[model samples]
Target: MSWKKSLLDWWGSAGYKKCSEKNRSVLKAAVSLMVVLFVLAIGVRAEKSVVIIDDGKELAVRTYAGTVADALAVKDIVLLNNDEVTPSLDSALVSGMAIRIDRATDVSISVDGRMLPVRTQCRVVGDLLNEAGVAPGPEDEVSPALNSAVTPGMNVVVARVVTKTEEKEAVVNFETEQKYTVNLPQGTTRIAEEGRNGTAQQIWKVKYKDGIEIARQLVSSKMIAPPVNQLVMVGSGLVVSRGGENIRYAEAIDMVASAYTHTGNNTSCGVAPHYGVAAVDPAFIPLWTKLYVEGYGYATALDVGGSIKGNRIDLFFESYNEAMRWGIRNVEVYRID
Candidate 1:
């Protein structure tokens, strides 16, 4: 009757009953508030739409958004530093409005597994591959065709490169000369002391990548034809001297036998001879002996000049003026010795 009875009596009082009802209403209100918050959250989440970017598609995307940056972020699109974004980040994004993104990237191309360097502005895998510097390998496959467009985050794969190599036959020619003897005069003949055959051959090699020539080997080499022999004759007879004493005399003509100047020196004077006309020995021939020089005109051995020495005869002109005018040159001397 003590504690339990007292607690039951207090609960049965009127103020306690009002307090309990007030507490129950407060609980109901709190539950209702939580439900509203949950519904509000669900509605806000539903407003965010997910965008999909397919491979080989344009970087410029169309969205019903209020800003360009917001639309790109929503679609999870990432832009490279060198990529161009049209309409700017803060530009309003309206329905049917395109947001173009031009991509600039460094692409590596490979031909027959050899790497090549390239820079690309294409957005799709196929375009970038084509822009890659490497030439297409035979039997090679690209993930996208050459005409296909490009897209972001797409990886292009190239497959199996087949190469065909074939050996082509070609010829190399070789030549050599052979010497033999023949008689100049009629009824004379000499022996063919030495002779050699000319050789020629064909070769074949397998060609590899990049049209590189390799595996050079000689297939066949043999003398296709014999070289023609050169002919030479031996001198046999000499005739006796039939000319008179004045023409028959032979003597030595020395350099500087008389005084003659080297008119033509280091400098070029067109086609004329620089030195005085070279003369044969006068002792072997004779001075004032009236001789016909094959290349040069008839000249007299009148003047003894210093330059005239050593198998040389100086011809004198009536005037020193004429001697200066004579050019140095080669002439055949018929001895009026």
Candidate 2:
């Protein structure tokens, strides 16, 4: 049968007769009222009730004909790059729809050994790790601590600090020093012993953060090649006696001594050349001075020669053969006045 005939049959069915006249009348009035209200609601169906959540805060609001972005603008909510939204701002709004915005904050982070440019919606350091998808062990370190509050662009460091002891060898520089001694006469010094640099073995406690060396502390140090202190002996005080007379002198040095003789001619000081006359450097031992040598006895410094300059002295001997015997010899000479 046709759907039209079936509907007419249902209207005349026994079930339709089961209702009382009074009840039927009430039902009929209710149906008529519902139909009229439904038609009126269709004309104003553009308005919707949307729930907005911003940073965990919820606001139930009614909006008139616009997208989700337009609805949030009416509430003066501005979206930033760090802010997040569910169902995106461009999506159309529907009645009784939930719009969630999880706002992100700029945060600094150091993971492992490197600093990271990060932005997250986490509110605490502990939550930050979850947002970063990092699970820290008991030995790992966290800056701003794990339970501390997090703010925008705050410093947060996660380090794995480990310690170990190590042994190392190092060089030590030797020291050079002087020693005053009365054994040697005054105004002379000599290096008694040469110094050699030393070596040492050391134990160090080292600290590494995230596999990078952070610090080291000396635990123990032992000398391997002990440092040798250079020793210099300096003369302190003295007096000497020579030529049947007591003489006082500041110092003595070696000199190249030679001999020249011309018994009859005069010397540079107008004194005739004699066995005791000595041509000496006036700058070192002045003319007309009395001096004594170690091997060659006493002499008078009463003459000067062109070749006699600085630590050089020409002595007078009785004969040329006698002078030739003393060709050149380093002799210790004393200064006496």
Mark the regions of model 1 whose C-alpha exceeds 4 Å error after superposition.
1-105, 108-176, 180-182, 185-203, 212-215, 219-337
Cα displacement (Å) at residue 125, model 2:
1.3
- Find the candidate with the highest TM-score and give its number: 2
Leading candidate by lDDT: 2
lDDT score for residue 332 of model 2: 80
Model 2 residue 336 distance off true place after TM-score fit, in angstroms:
23
**Model 2 lDDT per residue over 155-264, tens place:** 88888878889998988988988655555667689899998899999999998878889899999999999889898877745356666666554346589999887856
User: Tens digits of per-residue lDDT for model 1 on 231-285?
Assistant: 4333223222323322221221223322234444321213233233334354544
Relative to the true structure, candidate 2 has a C-alpha RMSD (angstroms) of 17.7
